[model samples]
Target: MLRRKQHRFQHNREAHNVIERGKELYTTIKGHWQEYFKNDNPLVLELACGKGEYTVGLAENRPDVNLIGVDIKGDRIARGSKRCIEKGLTNAAFLRTSIQYMDEFFEEGSVDEIWLIHPDPQPRDKEEKRRLTNPHFLTEYKKYLKPGGLFILKTDSPFLYEYTLEKLKEFDGYEILDHTNDLYQSPLLKDHFGIETHYEKLWVDKGYTINYIKCRVQ
Candidate 1:
């Protein structure tokens, strides 16, 4: 309970990088990102960004782009926001909100890239629609991602990897750019692959083969 209060305090106190619930900015920041970042850089989003590992990593790697981490957990978002503030990173920000309301926060064709890092597989047959790569989510992505924008998924679940592949195949105008059932063994591994999220490290330590897919929506 004390830790929750601390997180809430920190999350509310930090306005430079955190955009939490109950703020006017939460509803008004849709197309006014340039005013926030003070630049016209490409926009990238990390959905369900628990602790914002990818958001901070990508912001550090690509200063030319603006990255926003979106998640509903304020405590988790607080951690990432604190890290960004400590690192003095202006390109990284956190939005405390549910991923289902993504369209309300971003304009159509405004996102240049999106990363889904180790999202929950929602493995049960009845939970298929809740998977991040479900057709519904793909359509939501399509609504904001620019033409030829990249949609990258990194996961430790074979079920999700295969499910995403099947959905992408069925989805219109989604072109697969690269994929690997085992990311570390594949040549598709890039420099940014070195940044591992907390959950990713746990999965790797358990000898899970990380699956990765990169696609473009046309």
Candidate 2:
């Protein structure tokens, strides 16, 4: 494990698509996002992007929108960044950082949308604050999202699905766009449901149903 991690770290150092600690402009990437992509297109964030399946897939299909896959693991970032360069994808990049500090990297109202794809459910009652759909994380996400921007979540945890719905009811600044306990059984929205993460596939193969929630931040 140590050797593999070291190898990934070295590769990340040489990757232009991968940005990690010690990068000069890592903290101030928010206002300069368009300049980084060399375009004024809308920005989309994929939080907790492991292997960056959704990030790479979305960027490939939607060249008009820039996608940044955010995760703390150097190994995961290396995998995604390498794929982006190999595929010649200009619209996708990977950021190695804790999701708790997203506001430091993106300016308020800078992001057009956010994808909380298959994030940790934090199933225990004591860990509720750490859940991505918790009120605290929702507030952090809203800081970067544009007015009326979409906050989309896809998960396989029933606890998380119910928790998110309850939190959304308590928060007055957001309105539910749509939600489903079983994504495959309901009418599918192609754009949001098309990209599947590695963990998502594993859960589905084990007969677990996926849940999704879409809300607009006011």
Best by lDDT: 1
Worst 10 residues of 2 by lDDT: 188-197
lDDT of 1 by residue, 1-218 (tens): 98786866576566668886677888899899988899999999999998898899999989999999998887787778888888999999999888998877899999999999999999999998899999989999998999989999999999999999999999998999999999988887683548898877887888888999999999
The Cα local distance difference test for each model comes to 0.88, 0.87
- Clash count of each predicted structure: 0, 0
List ranges where model 1 is wrong by over 4 Å: 191-193
State, as a TM-score between 0 and 1, how close model 2 is to the true structure.
0.95
Error of 1 at 162 (Å): 0.4
